[model samples]
Target: MADVNCHKVLMKALDYDERGDKEQAIHYYTMAVELILSIEDKEKREKMNKFARQALDRAEELKGIKKNESPKESGKKSIQTQSASSPTTNAPNKTVPTVPTHSPKLEVTSKEGYTMEEKKVLEKTSTINAKVYVPFMEIDAKERFNFPIPFSDKDGILELSPKQKKEFVQWMRISELCQQPEIIIGTNPDYHAIKQTVVSDCSFVSSLTVAALHEKKFNRRILTSIIYPRNSKDEPVYNQSGKYLIKLYVNGIARKIVIDDYLPVGRHNQLLCSYSNNKNEFWVSVLEKAYMKLMNGYDFPGSNSNIDAYALTGWIPERISIKKNDPDFNGNQVFDRLKEGFHQGRCLITVATGELSDAECDRTGLVSTHAFAVINMAEVDGVKLLMLKNPWSHLRWKGNYSEQDSRWTPELQRILNYDPKMAQSIDNGIFWIDYYSLLNFFDVFYLNWDPELFKYTYCTHKMWQSGIGPVKDAYTIGDNPQFSLAVPQGRGSVYVLLTRHITSIEDFRENKEYITLLVYQHKNGKRIYYPHDPAPYIDGIRINSPHYLCKIRLDPNAARKYTLVVSQYEKTTTIFYTLRAYCREPFELKSLDTYLTTNLQVTGEWNSSNSTAGGCQNHKTYRNNPLYKVTLANDGNLAVELRAPKVFQVGLELTVKELDDSSLTAPFISKTTDNFRSGFCVLDLENLSAGKYLIRPSTFLPNQEAPFFLKLKSSAKLQIEKEQ
Candidate 1:
């Protein structure tokens, strides 16, 4: 009977596999494999194990293909071939049927090429169709004068400059702006042709420049992939209907931005916003317009290129300060890293200059507070060099490797594949700078790395409510949002990114909130009680930027589990955020949900008269600490937490007691906090027998008067009440 059931299950799985139902096929195949392995007769099991193994291998191959493909290319077909045979039971002295050596190929077509995992990503994304906002036919019929027009009640026109708003002649479509308007003028995006005009978004323009250069160098579409209205080849094309949808990674998820084709024109028939040098290429304008719309206009305040690049490509953003203030800033190490990362197509690099005086700028031929794209890096004959592009499309660096510099020897030119003379003829803002010169001239390096470099990625969206925890998390992190990362025994890189959602324009300009991430080595996935007790594996610096990244490396000898705490300097408002983790090795990431099935919270204060101000064990008044009675109905785990004001040091102590025992002097099993922490402490008891218990929450010092909150969590149903 068991053998017959296994054969029936295997046949059902094959039926699903032939019909391209991978989900059901995998399920039934796994079931059949498990059943066949349970047979007691070794000879009979071996006869059927081959078929079960084949089915299991095919299922695993399908899963592996889904894991290896990029999210965009996940829609491609996954094909496999399998023999059409079922396991058979042989009677004594009877011959078994021969399995076929070859069978027809089976093609499994995923819906829209998206697996269950990719569909989850799409479910979180917000799609906005332009036609729903402003019908394209309405604009063509003149029913609407302008698309995304400036109005007092809307986000439109807020980013426009005073000059742009005053000199704005009209909203002109792409066809009217140029004689032969094309979304992308050339076969590939040209980084040199991109020019910044009138707008103060040098960082954004520089971001686009390097992104375009990456595509040209590697033949990958980093910028164009976001824009919609594409041809069958997936290349972005101009939309005649005046409606387009562009996907941008913003706040936390991939959000589709819908915009019209109308471009802002000045009185002199010149485009008011950023434009491309090629008169007909409108991709630069279109992408910029969509991004500007997200920023709430053309009046874009300055931002680093890494942030812009993250929004454009969903890559990991990392900022490295080059200022002399940082004692650890090593120019040589940074250069080597950039060279390796850029050449390997794992990163996009951009450098920004600090505020420079006019004389300083003139001497170096560099712009003040401007962003420049690092398009290429080379090491020729031990001479380190970098190719940079100025978004202004003009000023070339007057440093050692400048066009007019004497460092350009024929030998150097040949090694670098150069034509300095031709480069000098056309002032296209491209120049070579020595690594040392770059270290001296640039103030910061913004690197956006390819997340695909890691085999696993995970993200979680959350909200941090104001007033839930202490405003300043300098001493304790028990109340902060925390996560657990379980890495298997291996050596690999792990990165955790905390992205604060941008709810308003003030998020960029005001710079009110400061946030960072802290990682620590933890055992048994326990919560971190104190900030510096365990010594953080990676202590991040707090910054107002939307993204904060914390990186750590795992070794086989190190602990397998870690705790990640999202810390804020002083939280003033309720903030929405997304935490994403990328790892080179397989890892498990999840929020540390501390709440149990049955929970209770109570508020109390340590004061002189109430007898609740009893201090630590050393003090005679410890017996007078605030006590609670806990009654458990079954064997389970119990967790007790004590939270006080920053002024007081607190801890929790739990003691198992008899059913009728009311005395505080004696207890069965006692567990106390390892140490008193400022404002927070925790005590966990696992596998306690069903019975009554007593919990004591106390301060560290005698006569410390402050309010505190005690919380109790248990797996089994329990009742907790303050002891009278």
Candidate 2:
């Protein structure tokens, strides 16, 4: 009965408040508070207190208004009061309509308990529709940006002139636009032109730069170096380092290569190299040995050999192997050498997108089954290795010989001795891999992307095609997952997006389910469960990680307003690592001041106190690793503001502190987005203390006057309210 009476009193207060009867509203409000206080439950009492505070705050705002003042005048005062005192800066200078800010009245109770204390209710106007205008450019500017790389001398930082930096950027763009050297040197006559042109136009500029730099730094011209591990006594293990080697191959033929004693060999028997002759030929030669080894001395044109061209027949090494029991294994640090090898070469590979259509190529480029490939080789450790890439960020070559492809055969099955399964997938044209070869080879190389900035690009290609069709002039390696060489412009460069977080689990079956809000029911909903499409609960994933998103093709009736409830299933958790390259967006030159004031707003406390300690932390395994977790809440509105002197480059650090840990650390920035609600930023937390943390939200573009607002209540608060 008491609970019912309290509810009735609350309803009465709401009614009087709606009807513009301030005195009556206060009267009912007091009654409701009294009724609520009578309840013995502590939680219930706290709820009543919150309600009472809201009522009182509203009354106070109306205190100064004349009883019969025109609604317009009253409305203006309300707007002014809300903006001037609100936590976020209320800029009155913009031209767009901004949702007015309102200060929340938090009712705090003693942790132990508190007795009810009554106070007089202030008065306020009821029906004033107040509005404010904000500028559009303010909200549209980039919220988070990276600082330009800086060069420093022994004395101090060397600042590049604006014109110099601009020129540097232009050079980079032009270089990227220039075509990369060709990957394939086909036997056909027409392809001869491409190969000749590649060899002709290819100046040793990059090679020359590297050579010159090394010469200037060192006293001699060097080709390659030997890297080895030292013993506990700090003695060089020369023989052990030789235990791992990177054999070289060109045009399907093994070539004698030299190694330097000064080369840095990583624990995992990794080898680093800056240049190679034929990447494709290298790959094919490596594959053939693993598939059909005729001993290191076997001549290519043998008495029993029937084929004219060299092609890999058996096993190829794809991954590094390091065992403590092994005579020279260096443990975890062993893998570091391979990573460095890629860096040395500036190994950026572009891949053809998707499978060429009948109008384009033969079979969908599904891996070993139909596609044949050749690669330039660089020997690492003692093992022979073939480095291949999934052109589509994360897709694997499905053919039998691919690295970690479906286990279809065994390595021992194809020793130098005869085995039926040997050369099994070779006919299908897929490159096969063997683990033994990796240990014997040195390190493989490829390019990498930074995980911090926003990236976007569009490209089309005229490519080559094969298999039962009109003598197709060229096939487009459409959306293929394998990596490609950046063919120079006339020869054509492959358009590709270099990214980290963007490569998500295209196969939903691999990932666990989370809370998902179903906005609309589809007629053929069962299609989502079909084998080809395995993505589960798309809405939440879409909402949480927009920065990593690709194309989202929704039904025509995709809801404009709806709720997506998401909760992690069980104790399963996810961590993300990122690789990225910059994606240029359509530019609109607008003033930074106007952009911040109208388009974006600040969140949390931002007084420039340099309290990096209080900022958000990300989930990181080590101080250098950063991981991010994004959740969709009722209040998720955000706008970014890029504020700096015009024509500036600065390296900005964005971090995420995992809320559930004690150490505030993150792995790496994962994603960047233009839309606040649709996309999320990748988090970086390398310099945080150990603990779970939240994204401070306040740290982005500190001191900038951009603005943003939440469209709904915070989920945590809503849950608490519901429980109460």
Candidate 3:
């Protein structure tokens, strides 16, 4: 009976696999394969071995990894291959949105990237976060928005001096022509309302797309975020209001965008910015313009869509990574977490393929290295589906669940809330794919979390002085821009996110600095380090480390202070940052802002003049080491540490010689054994009285010469310097 059940399940899985619901099929197939292989009798195992192995391979397909053959699959398994790699491009010289006009539409034939069932290719489809409302911050409109535009006519909308023409063409009011034209903050904002234009602000559009997906979750509040205070019938009203205001968070700071009703009109009264597909709709256009002005004109050099999502919806944008080769990849767990985030109104998930150029996207049948919003997830007839939308509203996935997929039955369609009339069109850019297909094709996931989930509070515009942190904080690489927090041992939970402000310098669009956030506890006068915990729960690392975060959990009686330090891999460039802490109750957060330790800190750098200078263990050039002298006026706890990049092999040695011992090789009072030989070396000493000690920095390998930095901190006033 057990054997018969396994066979029946495997058959059901195989049938679903043939039809396209890979997620559910994979689940059932995995169960059957596991059971079939578990048989004790060789005869029984042998009989099912062929199909079991095939199911094993197909099971991987569910996770979006390699796909070879399916159990009893016939002919060529019609799965469209992704596009070939393309050369990635940054903005023109790094700070401009350099997008050429979009090319004319081509006749998208089934043969293009639709390498799968002809019917599936025929189906074209479609498809951060932030804490927002705190005490409302009011900005002086006159001081902040100095640029003013007059409402106008014939020559378009607002008057712009020719000098500013490149940034903006002209602006017209919503009521310029229509006697009572008003911006509609729709009762329900749909994904169809958003379509990416010729700009490379996909990050911006993708984030917005995701937010639109959840507009209803927050009572459809995000859609009409920007409003004219003096409106009617509870809807946005327009009485030639002259100017409108939109509140957006930029790098943690909330700035109000005041705009004249004038619309930016291009060559023939064509609205230039992002406009809703509905010609009469002006919300998206106005919102985009406000965003453009907020970002210092439409000169977007490209940005993390999560960041845009934050500005738009005040939600925290977190990134999720799923490495196909990672041994620990669990599809079910990932889906479950995403589902929870969605239902709890905690996240808006987005996905992207590997970076590809326009040409590459065309050749491979993939959208141009773009981002997609996950609008829906459903399970029908045990078949799981993921509905995604392309921001461009064209060029969709050519794999399973495509517009022409023959699986769109009225029953399945109804389960997915499918619109039959809308489904008939291949250009809608909205489409569905099984979880397996999504995992297999897409590699990156952006989760823009709702701030409500954490009761988030933030401190924006925190400057991290380069010399003030890492290199200068202490010889310890982890002693940079830090803060201390306390959770009442068993408090609910806490999450902290640190975001580096995107630099506006023409040369530094992406993160010019590589930084990490580490949290440690200073207990019983000893430091405990957690290299990688809490990350699994927090926002974690995003596309890059520009925005990194972690969560914290405390133990009973362990309600001690946890110190969070932000340091860099390279450890040099300075950056301005924002720290947002989320917790059930108010977080006991305090900055490590220049305390007494700041006065006791000292840093010195030394380069190997010769291999003999910093003696090596094998070479025993002990006398040939660079020496540092420390003089403590009073008893002080002393810490000495050394650091060098990956390129160098170095070490630090300890030998307490009397301060007055002038001899180069004066017999050492106490010498280090094996503890100090490392790239990042530290020698922490306890209960030292006011006295002098000598420290040496050495290379662990013979004949090694590399520049290294050393940090010395003491409780008592002290002087430190390279020994002569």
* lDDT (10s digit) by residue, model 2, range 289-363: 221121211111111110111111100111222343677576334434443433343221111122234532332
For model 3, state the Cα shift of residue 318 in Å: 0.8
Query: What is residue 524's positional error in candidate 3, in angstroms?
Result: 7.9
User: RMSD in angstroms, candidate 1?
Assistant: 24.6
lDDT per residue as tens, model 1, 324-352: 54678777788899999999888999999
TM-score of each: 0.75, 0.18, 0.63
Off by over 4 Å in 2: 1-238, 241-371, 374-572, 582-724
lDDT of 1: 0.73
Candidate 3 residue-wise lDDT, 395-456, digit = tens: 76666676667777887777777764576565767778877777766777877766665543
Q: Which regions of candidate 1 are displaced past 4 Å?
A: 1-159, 324-327, 557-559, 597-599, 605-622, 633-637, 643-650, 659-668, 677-680, 687-689, 699-708, 713-718
The alpha-carbon lDDT assigned to residue 689 of candidate 2 equals 29
Model 2, 572: alpha-carbon shift in Å? 7.7
Candidate no. 3 TM-score: 0.63
Output the number of the TM-score-best candidate.
1
Cα error of candidate 2 at position 669, Å:
38
The prediction achieving the highest lDDT against the true structure is 1
